[model samples]
Target: MILIDADACPVKTEITEVAIRRNIQAIFVAGSYLRVADHPLIRFFAAGDAFDAADDAIAEVARPGTVTITADILLAQRVIEKGGAALDPRGREFTPASIGDVVATRDLMHELRPGLEGQTGGQGGGPKPYAKADRANFKNALDRVLTRIARG
Candidate 1:
């Protein structure tokens, strides 16, 4: 199963296409209603407008056989703790060996965010614009991870 943190995700179209083609069960969780594909394997979940509500919803169902797509390191850590796999939208897979460092770095960045906010002078701030290459990378990574899980 593929659990997606749908809000602010850039590769939703690609994810939907790949899930349908692979006949995978993909549950898209968001803060509110989202128009999802009309298919048996494609599902949509509205987690409400509370903080981390969507992440909480996704984590609740995360398990050994599930793969969650999220960019939030904290949510990814929670999913990993539950023995599920987590992948960033940019195609980076969070693993047991790497999650620790990833979390620490994320925390450090958060701590430094206040100081760095105005220092950039409107340059080098926030995530880069999603590109075609990023979409392709995400599709490839999703396929590879799903194939690995299927094999197991």
Candidate 2:
């Protein structure tokens, strides 16, 4: 199963296209974003109105090798530690070995965010143009996840 953390998610359309091409199931899970479409292959779940509830739900039900598309490093850590694949749409891969330091830096930055209220560094390195190269990379990553799950 391909699980998406849909709150502030980029690449939904890209993921949908890939899922269609691969003939697999893709579920977009959200907490309160109620504007998602209703599609046969692409399922949408509104877990709750609370923050991060969708993340918790996805983490709870995800098996040993599910693919979770999320930008949150914290959630990625949980899923990856459970033997799953956590992918950022921008192509960052999270794992147990690196999650600790990453999370610490992320949290520290969050704590010190108030100091950068006027810093013009505005959220760089987001999902790029979903180019052919990105599609190829994403396809390979999805294939790796599927292969690992199949082996288990």
Candidate 3:
């Protein structure tokens, strides 16, 4: 299973394709701004109005061994605490014990680099570079996780 923060996600289509190919169930949690697809394996849940409503929804639904896609350092930490795996669209994975350090470092970066506003998704930057290498890397990671699930 997978939970995706669809509102500001960049690899929505790519993730959907990969999930479909793998026959995995993925629920995309979004706010009112995102228009998500309706599929058997992939569903969308609208959290109405709230800043971290989508995050709450995904965190509530995600379980151990499930993959969560989100760029929010805070939210990823929450998922990690719940024993789920969190991944950024850039393919960075966050674990339960490491989330605290990651969040602390991210906050420190914000303090040190005040003017540096990071951009992962959304229209604030140009189109994301979806290289073939990225696709291959994601595929490999996806397969590795699936293999682990199978092993267990």
Candidate 4:
């Protein structure tokens, strides 16, 4: 199963395509309804309008054999601790070995946000624009991880 944190997800189409090709169950979870492809292997789950609702829903279902796609570092940490694989939309996989450092860095940046905001007029630079290469990398990473899960 592939669980997607889909509110701001940029690779929904790519994920659906891969899910279809691989005959895998891919569930897109969001805070509200989002049109999804009409396929048996693909599903849409509306987690309602609560803070972190979608993330909580995804975490509840995460375990071994499940690959969760998310960019939220905290969510990734939760998934990993539950024995599920977590991959960022940019194709970076979060493992137990690396999540601690990743969480620390994220926390540091968060703690620095107030000071940085004062310096930059309260505007922080978000992620870079998603590119063709990112899409390709995500596809490859998803495939590789799925294959490994299937083999085991």
Candidate 5:
């Protein structure tokens, strides 16, 4: 199963296509209703309008051999701790050896965000714009993970 923290995810269509082609079940968990395409292999779960609701729901459902897609470092950590694989939208895979450093860096960034905002006159910078290359990378990463799981 592929568990997705779907809010703000840019690879939904790509995921659906790949999962369907591979005959894998994909569950997209979101904070509210999202208009997903109709597909037998794809399921959507709305976790309501609460902070981390979708992440929490995904954590509950993900298990060993499950693949989780999320950009939240904390959520990826949780998924990794649960014996599942986690991949960021930008194709970064979160693993036990790397998650700690990632979390610490994320925490440091969060702590410095206010200072950064002040420096930038309250106009904070956002992530780089998503590009076709990112989509291709994500697809490749997903395929590799799925293939490894299938082999095992």
Candidate 6:
């Protein structure tokens, strides 16, 4: 199963395309109803209006061997803890060996954001814009992960 944190996800179409081609199941968890392609392999779960509700829903369903897609570092950590592989939209896979440093860096950035904002007069840079290259990388990463799982 490929579990996706759908809110703000840029690669939904890419994921669904891959899932369809690979004959894999994909569940997209979101805070509200989102239009998804009508396909038997694709499922959508509405997690309701609550902070981290979608994340909680995903955590509950993801198990070992499942692939989770998310940009949230904390949610990725949780999935990794459950033995699931976590990949960001940019195709960066989070693993046990790297999650700690990623989490710490994220925390440090969060802590510094306020101070930086104050110093910079509320100007803050957001994540880089998604690009076609990112989509290609995500497709390749998903295919590689699925192939490895199938081999085992």
Off by over 4 Å in 2: 33-39, 115-140
- What TM-score do all the candidates reach, one by one? 0.92, 0.75, 0.80, 0.94, 0.92, 0.93
Residue-by-residue lDDT tens digits, candidate 5, 61-150: 778899999998999999999999999998889999999999998777776666553552233487899999999999999999999888
Whole-model Cα lDDT per candidate? Answer: 0.91, 0.76, 0.76, 0.93, 0.90, 0.91
Write candidate 3's Cα lDDT for 43-125 as tens digits: 78888678789988888877787888888888888888887778877777777667888988876665654343564222234
Best by TM-score: 4
TM-score of 3: 0.80
User: In model 2, what are the clashing residue pairs, if there are any?
Assistant: none
Per-residue C-alpha lDDT of model 4 across residues 1-152, encoded as one tens digit per residue: 99999998999999999999999999999999999999999999999999999999999999999999999999999999899999999999999999999999887787676555356224458889999999999999999999999999
By lDDT, who's the top model here? 4
RMSD of each: 2.8, 3.8, 4.4, 2.2, 2.4, 2.3
Candidate 6 TM-score, true structure as reference: 0.93
**Candidate 1: residue pairs that collide:** none
Model 1 TM-score is 0.92
Give Cα distance to truth, residue 24, candidate 2, Å: 2.0
Q: CA shift at 119, candidate 6, in angstroms?
A: 12
Candidate 6: minimum summed lDDT over ten consecutive residues — where? 115-124
Which portions of model 6 show Cα errors greater than 4 Å?
115-123
Q: Cα miss at 108, model 2 (Å)?
A: 2.5
Residue-level lDDT of model 2, residues 33-112, one tens digit each, is 54544567788888898877998988886766578988888888878777777887765667678888989988776665
Candidate 3 clash pair list: none
